[model samples]
Target chain A: MVIALCVTVALAIMPLVGVPKSWILYIFLFFIYLAMANMWNLLAGYSGLVSLCQPAFLGLAGYAMTIGTWLDIPWWAGMIGGSLIAGLFALLISSAVFRLSGVYFAIGTLVVPEALRMIFFLWRPVGGAMHGAGAGYMIKGIGDLSPHVVYWLSIFVGVGSLFLVKGILRSKLGLGLSAIRDNERAASSSGIDVFRLKLYVFIISAIITGFAGTIYYLYQGYIEPTATFNVRWTMTLLLATVIGGIRTVEGPVVGTVVVVFLYFLLARYAGYSLLIQGIILVGIMLISPQGIVGILRRSKFYDSIVKRMK
Target chain B: MIYGGDIITPILMGIMLGGLYALIALGLSLVFGVMRLINLAHGDFVVMGSYIGYALMRNFGIDPILGLIISIPVMFVLGFFIQKYLMGRAFAIASEIPLIIAFGISLIIQNAHQIIWTPLSRALNTPYSHMSFHIGERQFPVSYLLDFVAGILIMLFLRWFLKRTYLGMAITAASQDKRVAQLMGINTGRVYGYAFAIAMVSAAIAGVFLGMTFPFTPTSGISFLTIAFGTVVIGGLGSMLGTFIGGIILGVVQTIGGYLFGPASQMLLVYIIVLVILAIRPQGLFGK
Candidate 1:
C-alpha cells in the first residue's frame, strides 16, 4: 500500500528532517501506539481474547530492562530478553487463563497485572523508596540512552510489528485463530487445537506489546509499577482497534494515527481533554460500531463511485 | 498482636464493611441478571450518590443515614432514564457497544466530578462521622452498625419484592429468559428500567456509607468498581443473598490481609481470594 511506502520513507528520512527533537519524540510515541494496537488487534480482534492485561507485559519488560541492565546485560539485549520473558510468562499463565471463558477470562487476565503491580510496588529491593521498581537502578546501566536511539528503535519495532502480524495472519495460525473466534466449539470439534492456537497468539501478542514497553522505558529511562501497569494502556488500544475497525489489517494503523494526533492536540489544547475524549469515544461507539475505518469504507469518497462506473 | 480486641475489632468491622459492599454489588448483580449488561459506571454512580449525600449533609444539615434515604429515590429516577435512553440504545446496537459506552460514561463522570467538585478529597466531616459505641469494651463505629442494618434491610426488601410482588417476578422472569418473558407479554423494557433503578438505590446506599466511612474523590470509583465486581463474582452471580455474604467474606479477608501484611497488601489479598474462589468454584458457591 502507498501508506506503507510513505511510512517507510518517513522512517528513513525522519532523522534527517530539520525538526525539533520533541516532534520526533512525539512521532516515535505514535509509532509505539501503532504497534501496541496491532498486537491487541491480533489477540482481541482476531482471537477474541479481550484481555485487559497488556500493561502487565509492558511493566514486566520495563522492570526486566532495568534489572537486566543492572546485572550487566546490554540495553538492547536486555529489552529483547524482557520481551522473551514476558512471552514465556504469558505461555505459562495461558494454561490457567485459558480455562476461563468469555468475560471471566478478561477479568482473570486483569487480575494478573494488578497483582504484579502490587508485587512490583512492594518489591523494595529493586525500587528502594520508589512506588515501583524505580529509575535509580536504571541509571547504573545504560548511561545516557540517547533520545535518537530510542526514536529509531521505536520506528524499527513499529515496522517489525507490521511484518510480524502480517506473517501470522497469513499463516495456519491466523486461519485457526479466525475459526476459534467465530465459534470455539465448532473449531474444537474440527480438531483445530483451539487452546494451543489461542495460547500461541496470546504469547506472541504479549511479546510484541512487551517490547513496546521496553522501548518506552529505554527512552524515558524510568519505570513505575503503577504507571506501567495502568489499565488505561489496554483501554487506549481497545479504543484504537475499535475506531480503526476490528479484524482489518490497515484499521489499527489508521486508528492509531488519528488517535495519537487527536490525543496530542486535545491534551495540549483542550481544557477538558478527558471529557472530550470520553464524549468522542462514546459517540464513535454509539454512532458506528464499525469504527473510523468502517465509516470511511461506507463513505462515497473512499468507496470510489467512479471505480464502479469503470 | 495477641490482644482479643485487635483481631475481633477488624473481623467485626469487616463484617460491617461487607454490608456496604453487598449493597453496592447488589445493583450490579440485578442488572447483570436482568439484562446481562455490566455498567462499569455503577461505581461512579455510587460515588455520585456519595457526593450528593455529602452535599445534603454539608448544605442541609442532614444525617448521612437520612441523606441516603433521600439520595435513593433521586438516584433511582436518574438510573431509570439512563437505562431507558443511553444504555438501552447502546444495547440495541450491539453487546460490546454497551461496555465501551459505559467506559466512556465513566470517563465523563469522573472528569465532570473533577471539574465540578475539584478532586480535593472530600468526606462527610460531621460530628457523628467519627462517633462510635462500645461493644464489650471494644470500640465500634455507630455508622458502621447503621450501614450494616441498612444493607440487611435492603436485601430483605429485595427478597420480599422479588418473591412476593408481580413486578418482582416479572423482572426475575425477564432475567432468566427475556425472550420467554416477552412471549408471556411482560414488558421487558419496563422491567429493565426498574432493575436499573433498583440497582441505583443499592449504589446510593453504598455511597452514603462510603461518605461516612472514608474520604473519596472523582477517581475513587474504579477501586470501588473493582471491589463490587469482586464481591459479585465471589458471592456467586444471580444470588442477592450470596452477594451479601460474598461482600462480608471479602471484607473479612481484606481486613485480615491488612492485619497480617500491612495495608498495601490488602488489595492483593482480596484479588487472590477472588481468583481462588473462581478457580475452585466457577459457578460460585451459591450460584445454582
Candidate 2:
C-alpha cells in the first residue's frame, strides 16, 4: 500500500517536473481506462453482473457534461450531476432487468446503450442543426482549462476506484456479493438481500464509470451520440478485465496497462485492432478463462513469492 | 387526418415486415431452445449469409435465392464445427462462457466483414428488385411478398420436422432436460451440434431474403440482432408459432412508430416495447 501511494505521488508530480506532454497524455488515458476497467471488474468479476450497458453510463455522462457546459453550468458540477443521472438510470432499470437471470440478464442490459444512442440521435435538445449525422455538442469554455487539471482528475479517479474495489472486497457487502455470485438462491435463502446487493454494485459501478467518462470527454472537448455510446467501450472493458485477471483487485490495473499499450501499438491499424482483440478474447477464454492473473497464480514464481511473504 | 387506409396500410406493411423478422429470429430461437445458449453472432451469421449470396451473385451471376443452396450447407458445416468445438468446450467451463465466446465471435465476424467487404453498404439486386403488385389502392413489393412466403414455409417445415423426425425429437428432448435426454441414450452433444447447424441453415435463408429486401453493411448485424432478440422475447422462448406472431407485432409497431415519429424513431420504439414486454411478461405471449 505504501509503495502504491509512493508511485501515485510520483505520478502526480511528473507533470510539474517537466515531463513530456505526450507522456502526460498517455498517462491520462491510462488513468481513465484504469478507472473504467476497475468498475467493470467490480461488476462482472465480483458481483457476477456481466453488464454490457456501461457505455450508456459513460456516454450519458459525456452528454450531460457537454450539454451542461453549453448552458453555462460549471464542468465539475456537470460531472457530478452526470454521474448521479447515470446512477439514477441504473436504479430505474434495475427492477426491470433484475427480473432476468444469467444470459437473459446480459442480453437485457445489452440494448440499453443502443436505445440511448438512438434517442440521442433523434433528440437534439440543445442543438439546432445536425452535426455530421449525430447530435454532437462541443464542450464550452474548454479552451481555458489546462490539460494537467484533467490529467490529475483522471489520476484521482483511477486511484479512487482501486481503493473503492479494495474497500468493497473487505467489507460485509463484498462477502454477500461473492455469496450471491457463487449461488444466488442459496445466498438469498441464507439471509443475504441478493437484489439489494446487486443493485448497490450496479449503481456504484455506473456512477464511477460515468465519472471517468465525463473526465475523458472533457479531455476530448467533444461528445457525440454514436461514438460516445458505441459498443467499443464495452469491448475495451471486457478485454481489459478478462486479460488482467477477473475477480482480483489487481487484475484491472495490470490489464489496463496492457490494453493502453496495445491501443497505441495498434493505433495505426484501427480496423484490425478490434479483430485482433476479439481473437485474443476467444483464445483466452478457451485456453485460460482465468486470464493472465490466473496463469500467474498457478505459476511456481507466484508460489515462491507468497511463501516468502508468509 | 385519420383514415382507414392509413391504419390498414401500416398494418399490412408491418405484417410482411414481421414475416421477415420471424425468419431472421427463427434461427436464434431454435439455437437458444436447444442449447440454452444465445448466439450473439447469430446476426453476424445472417449477415454472412447475405455476403455469401452477394458473392455468388457477383461472381457467378446466380440469383440470391438460388445461391442459398451453397450458403446453407456451408453455414451448416460452420455452425456445427463452431458448436461442437468452440461453444461446446466453453459450455463445460461455465454457462456464461459460451455467451462471451459468442460475443467474441460476433466481434470477429463484424470486423472481418468490414475488412473484407470494405464496410460499404451493398444490396442484392434481384430481377424483381423494383417490381411490385397492386392490391386495390395499395402496392406490395414482390420481394416482401416472397420473404413472407419463405418465412411461413420455413416455420411450417420446422414445426413438422420437430414433430415427425427422430433428430428433431431428440433436439426437443434435449432442450427439455439434458440429463434425462442423455439418460435416454440421446447424444445431447451431437443433438446440440445438429440444432446449431439447422439454425445456421435457417439463418442463411433469412440472410438471403434480408439481402433481397434491404441494403446491408457489416454493422447491420447488430440491428438485426436486436430485432431477433426482441422477437424472441415478445414471442416467448420455445414456440415457433409464437415467434411468428411476435415478429408480426414488432413489425407493425415499428412501422406505425416510423409513420408517426419519422424513420429515426422506428428502432427506438421497438426497444421501448421490448423493455415494456420484458417488464410485464418476461415469459412472452406464448411462452409456457
Candidate 3:
C-alpha cells in the first residue's frame, strides 16, 4: 500500500519535469510486464510448472476487452470480466493438464494458446481473421486522460498483484501448492489434494495475466493475434522471472523494469536486443542460480543493512 | 466430407509429409534424448541448413539434392564444436540455462540470416521440380518420393548405428543416464558431442528437403519448429518410431484440417489433438 502511494505520487510528478509521452507510455507498458512476470513467477517459480504459455491468457484477456468495448460495456468492468473468463479457462485446462509432469505440462499449456490464436485468426466476428481486430479502445471524457492516469493505473495493478500473491502464500492453499512443488507424491500422502491446489494456482495466475492483457490493449488501442499472443511474450515473462529471482515477490518487478529498460534503450538495433537478453539470461543462470535480486540479498552490504534494521 | 479423393490423398500426403516432419524433428529428438537439453536454437540450425544448401547450389552449381551431402557434414562439424565449447558448460547449470542460451543463439542466427540472405524468400529449382507421377486422380511429386525414401533410409541407418556401433551405443547409454555411462568408463562428454553433431546433420538434411519443396524465408522455420515440437511430443519423446509416426499424424491433421476447415484451421486441429493427447496420455503415445 505504501509502495502504491509512492508510485502514484511519483507518476503525478513525472510530466511536470518535461518527460516525453513516449517514455510515459513505456513506463505504463513496463507495469503490464511487471504484472505478467509476477503472475508467471508465482505460478511456475513457486509451483514448479515451468510454463511458457502465460501470454496466451493475456491475449485472451486483450481480445475480451476489445469485444466487450465493441459491445458497449464499461471498460474497467470488461477488464475484470476478461480476467474472470481467462481464470475460468485456466481452471478448465488445469484439471486435465496438472496430471502431467515436467515437460509434458509445459508443452500442453503451449498448445491451447497457439490453437486459440489460430481459431481467432479464422473467426469472422472478431474482425476479418487476417486483418485482426481494429483499434479497440474506450475514449473517456477527453482523450486518454493523459499518460499519467495510465501510469498510475499500471502501478496500482502491479503492486496489487504482488499483495494478492503475498496474501495467498500466507494462506493454507499456498502452502499446499508449495508442498506440491517440493514433491507431489509426498504432498499427496500428506493429504494436500495436489490437483485442486494446482487448479487454484493456475486460475489465479490466469486472472492476473488476463488483467495484463486488458491493460495492454487499452493502452495500445489495438489487438493483433500475432503480436498479442506471440511466443516472444511468454519467453520475455519467463526471462524476467528467471532473472529477477523466480520465487520471490520483488524479483519479477525488478527484472521486468531492468529488461524493459534495456529493450527500450536498445530498440534501435536489429539483433542486439535479443542478443543482450540471451546473454543476460544465460549468464545469470550459470553464474548465479538464484537470480539478480537473490544475489543482491545475499551480498554483504544487504546483509549488514538487514542486521542493523533487526 | 470424406470422399475417396479427400480422404486418401490427404492421408497419403500426410504420411509423405510426416516423413519430412520426422526429418525436421530428428535433430530435436536426438539432442533432447541424448543430452537432456532442448536446444531452442534447433529451428535456427535448420534455417542455417537451408542457407547452406542455397549457398552450395548458387555458388558451385550443385543441384539442391547434392547440396544436402555437403551441408549435412558441415553442420555436424559445427554442432560437434558447439557442444564441446559452449554447451558443455551449460550442463553444469540447471536445464533451463541451455534453453535460454539456445534461444539467444536462435536470435543471433536469425538476424545473421536476415543480413546475409535478406528478407526475400527463395525456392530451389531443378529439372525435376515440377515432375509428378499421377496415381488415379491424385498427383504426387517426385521430390516427395525421394524425400520419403531418404527419410526412411536415414532413420534405418541411425537405428543400425545405435545398435551396431560402439559410439552409437555410448550415445544411447549416455542419454539414458550420464552417471551410468560414466561408470561404464565412457567419455560422456564425447558422446554428448557426437550426439549433438549427428542431430545437426539430420537437421541439415531436413532443411535441404524443406528448401527444395517450398520457398524459405529466414523466419519460415518458426512454424515448422512448432509443428515439429508438437510431433515429437505426440510421437513420444526419445522414441524414434514414435517420432516418425507422430510426424505423419501431424501431417495428416494439417492436410485433412486444411481440406475440411480451411488452411487457417490446420494448426488449430494439431493443437487440439496435442491437448487431448496430453490430457489422456501425458507420457505421449509411445514415450518411455
Candidate 4:
C-alpha cells in the first residue's frame, strides 16, 4: 500500500517536474486505457458478462460530452452527465440483453453500438449539415486547459478504478459477483439475487467506461461517430484484459501497459497493428488461456513471494 | 398505378434480397445449430470469399460465378482445417474459447484484406453486371435474379444432402447429441469438420453473390454478419425453412425501411426489429 501511494505521488508529480510532453501523453493514454480495462475486467473476468457493447457506452459518452459542450455545459459536468447517460442506456438495454446468455449476450450487445452508429450518422442532434462521412463534432471549449490538468484527471479515474475494483472484490458485492459468475442457477438457489448483482456490475462498468471515454475524447478535443463507436475499442479492451491477468486485480494494469507500449511501437504501421494484436490474442488464448497473470501465478517466483508474504 | 409501382417494386426487390439473405444466414445457422458455436468471424469468411472471387476474376479472367468453383473447394478445405485444428482444440478447452478465437480470426481477416487489397471498395463485375430485366414499368437487376436462383438451388441442395447422404445424416446425428452420435460409431470430430466445411461452402457462395450485389470494403464483414445474424434469429436457429422466411421478413423490412427513411436508417431498423424479436421470442421464430 505504501509502495502504491509512492507510485501514485510520483505519477501525479511527473508533469510538474518538467517531463516531456510526449511522455505525459503516453501516460495519459495509459491511465485512460487502464481505467477502461479495469472496468472490463470487473465485468468479464469477475462477473462473467462478456459484453461487446462497451463501444456503445464509450461512444455515447463521447457524443454526450461533445453535445453538452455545444450547449455551454462545462467539460467536467458533461463528463459526469455523459456517464449517467451511459448508465441509463445500460439500464434500458439490460432487460433485452440480460435475457440472452453467454455468447448471445455478447452478440446482442455488439449490435447496440452499430445501431447507435447509424443513428448518430443520420441524426445530427446539435450539428448543421453533414460535415464529412462521419458527421463528427468538435468539442467546444477546453482549449485553454493544460495537458497536466487532463493528465491529473486521467490519474484520478485510473487510480480510482483500481481502488474501486479492490474495494468491490473485498466487499460482499464482490463475493456475490464471483458466486454468480461461477454458477448463476446455483447462486440464485443459494439466495443470491443473481439478476440484481449482474445488473449492478453491468451498470457500474458502463458508467466507468463512459467516464474513461469522456476523458479520452476530452484529451483528443474531438468526437466523431465512426471512430468513437468503432469496434476497435472493445477489441482493445478484450486484448488488454485477456493478455494481462483477468480476474486478478493487477491484470488490467499489466495489460494496459503492454497494450499502450504496443500501440506506440506499432503506431507507424497502422495497418499491421490490428493484425499483430489479433495474432497475439489468438496465440495467447491458444497457448495460455489463463493469460500473463495466470502464467505468473503458477511460476516458482510467484509461489515464493506468496510464501514470504504469508 | 405509379404509386403502386413504388410499393410493389420494393417488395419484389425485398423478396429477392431476402433470398440472398437466407443464403448468407444458412452457414451461420448450421454452425450454431450443429456445434452450438457462433463463429463471430463468419462474415469475414464471407468477405474472404469475395476477395478470393475477386482474385480469380482479376488474375485468371474467370467470372466470379465461375470462380466459385475454385473458391468453394478452397474455403471448404480452409474451414475443415480451422475446425479440425484451431476451433476443435479451443472447444476442448471451453465453449466460449472458440468465440474468442473466431474474433481473433475476424481481426486477422479484416486487417489482412486491408493490407492486401487496400481499403478501397470493390465489386465483382460480370458481363451482365449492368443488365436489367424490365417487368412492365419496373426493372430488376439480372444479378438479383441470379442471386435468388442460386440461393434457392443451394437451399434445395442442402436439404437433399442432409436427407439423402450418409455424411449428412452423421452431421444431423452429431448435432442432435455428440455423445450419442459417438456411441453410435460416428466420429463426431470429423462430422463437425465436415459440417463446418459445408457451412464455409455456403459462405463462399453467398460471398460471391454479395460482392456481385454491392460494393464492399474489408470492413464490410461486420455489416454482413449482422444481416446473417438477424436472418438466423428472425428465422429460427437450425431450421432451414425458418431461415428462408426470416430472411424474407428482414429483407422486406430493410427495403421498406430504406424507402421510408433513406438508406442510413435501414440497418438501424433491422437492429430494432432484431431486439424486438429477441425480447419477444428469444428462442426465435422456429427455435425449440
Among these predictions, the greatest TM-score belongs to 4
B111-161 in candidate 2: lDDT tens per residue?
999999998999999889669987789987888888888889999999998
Better of 1 and 4 by DockQ: 4
What are the clashing pairs of model 1? none
- DockQ of candidate 1? 0.64
Best by lDDT: 2
Q: Tens digits of per-residue lDDT for model 1 on A1-310?
A: 5656675777757768777766787688888888899999898889988888899888888788878776677888888999998998898778777888777787678788888888887775543334233323343466766677788888888888888888999999998988888888999999999888988988898899999889988877767777787877877787778777777776788778767777777665442677777787788877777777777877788767324522
Q: After superposition, how far is residue B107 of candidate 4 from its true place, in Å?
A: 1.0
Give fnat, all candidates: 0.53, 0.68, 0.57, 0.60
Off by over 4 Å in 3: A1-8, A126-147, A302-310, B1-5
The CA lDDT at B283 in model 1 is: 53
Q: Which pairs of residues have clashing backbones in candidate 2?
A: none
Over A131-230, each residue of candidate 2 has an lDDT whose tens digit, in order, gives 5557587888789898889999999999999889989998999999999988889999999999899999999999999999999998988888898888
TM-score of each model, in listed order:
0.94, 0.95, 0.91, 0.95
Backbone collision tally, model 1: 0
Comparison by TM-score, 2 against 3, better one: 2
All candidates: DockQ: 0.64, 0.65, 0.57, 0.67
Whole-model lDDT, model 1: 0.81
Pitting candidate 3 against candidate 4, the one with the higher lDDT is: 4
Candidate 2 displacement at residue B252 in angstroms: 0.8
Q: What DockQ results for candidate 3?
A: 0.57
lDDT of each: 0.81, 0.88, 0.78, 0.87
Prediction 2 TM-score vs. true: 0.95
lDDT of 4 by residue, A153-172 (tens): 99999999999998999899
